[model samples]
Target: MNLIEHLKEDVRFEESLKACMNCGVCTAICPAAEFYDYDPRRICDLVQRGDEEEIEQVLRSDTIWYCGQCMSCKTRCPRGNVPGELISVLRKVSQELGLFRHSEKGRQQVLLMNSVHRNIMEIGYCVYPDRVDPDYHPEQGPIWRWYHEHIADIAPKLGANYHGAGPGALRDISEEDLQEVRKIFEVTGGTEFSEKVKKNS
Candidate 1:
């Protein structure tokens, strides 16, 4: 299928893009636009035009990855278009087509696969405390270092299970439950998607 056809295959494409009057409301409210050279309004316009070459350029660019998926654009859109949701469709298509490797931000999917995806598949937590080593995450700074060092003590105080069993924050997920999680991913094509991201990266 072509880029537009691939995009249309995603349910979010039709749901997110009803109409775009180019009012730029989505861009105005987008947090990513302030931090990056991203414009949700422009993305909507580009996808709405159904220009295959333009859409392919978008799929290969960093613009799609710039969306944080906070869904803030959904709140204020006069036409009820959800640019954040549209970005999700674009990113998925990019990854499936292996075009994500063409951009710097898109290539970060490998790191995410290693960290978040690995954590989920193994421990059933996307951001497991143990995997969040401060050495790799320097931006976490001294406080995170202190927390990392004293998580055993701090976690208990904060009512987190912290790798322990039973129901609580940061608790250890049972093997049975982890298997269930894996099954969900497998059935949902998440495992296939992860493999695609790895292969593309």
Candidate 2:
């Protein structure tokens, strides 16, 4: 069982596979699988068979970004395998590969990641990055004030607190880690600032 290097959490892919029932249900229910012809069943089967390349190919696919973390497939799986969780772990790995920032879907994930990083920098908890409605209203009294007040209402639905006025995000990350992330982002051209620049230019 070789360990895969990851950028964020240390996800043990092997541990998530103990309950693989080979029922083919995960492949059936995955939205990405349906839309992109991605087969989680095949990926899992190949990984179990010691075929790392096949699993790697699956990891490289853009199809992985569709998982919404609903856990619907996980609850219904007869094999006890949480394909959704596995997809999440794969998404983390995919982000490491810098594939996450390429498409619009991927960019959305990057925004979420940036939000969490900002939380780590400012407040310790990862708050949802306050999204603005289509109609820009100055009467809303600044974005922060609106987010601070109304964020609590959505907490119950999200299943997270995400509202505590904790310390703001860190202004500076460790130089070494920051450099590494930047280098990786630069290589993939995935940084939001980079994308914005590219589009404007």
Candidate 3:
């Protein structure tokens, strides 16, 4: 099928993904693949086959949701396949399919993304959902705080730079957006965990 026609229905696997070696290295490290039926290798394989039916089922499966997009798979994939990016593509398709507009977790994820964009856009980085890390030590705090306080330095480590500042930023977030993230965190208990991480940091 042509690109336009494919976009109208199922997401094409793309030639880049068809290069997968099926070495299972991705599964060896995947936290979700180990426990769930989802496998990055298989997902890539199905996408390569243009098996829209099974691929659609895979999209809704916890497989897509459980992917952390850590890029560990990407960095390690000898074939240069980006499993994380593929998952993001699947997720967008999932949303366009009206799959997420109905699910509770999907609703929560959308809420979380809005909150994160708002907070980081204004604050650079944040101790979001405000959850503290119990394992936090004075020498090193949890990932969020460490990322927030020194984003200029730590962000590069995470692969993205944290670049945003107050009303001067491109998008101005309202008070509602800030509160929205906190509320989401409240549901996720991120606030409590953030406090713990920051205190130690």
lDDT against true structure, model 2: 0.57
Top candidate when judged by TM-score against the true structure: 1
Per-residue alpha-carbon lDDT of candidate 2 for residues 1-201, written as tens digits (9 for 90 to 100): 132434124455645565565778877777767677567776556556655565565555666666666666776678777766777777666555555555455556646555555453343335434533324335656665666566667555665545343223322235565567666666764565444523422
Report the candidate with higher TM-score, 1 versus 3.
1
Model 2 regions more than 4 Å off: 1-12, 19-21, 29-38, 97-108, 123-201
Name the 10 consecutive residues with the lowest summed lDDT in model 1.
123-132
Look at candidate 1 and tell me the lDDT of residue 81.
Answer: 94
Ranking by TM-score: 1, 3, 2
Tens digits of per-residue lDDT, candidate 3, 1-201, equal 232234334343452364776897877777767666658888777776666677666655555776777778877788888777777777655555545444444444554444554455444344432223334434554665665456566544655423433443222345677667668776865564344322322
TM-score of each: 0.94, 0.51, 0.52
Residue pairs with backbone atoms closer than 3 Å in model 1 (clashes) = none
By TM-score, how accurate is candidate 3?
Answer: 0.52
Span of ten consecutive residues with least summed lDDT in model 3: 1-10
Find the candidate with the highest lDDT and give its number.
1
What is the C-alpha local distance difference test score of candidate 1?
0.92
Candidate 1 vs candidate 3, lDDT winner: 1
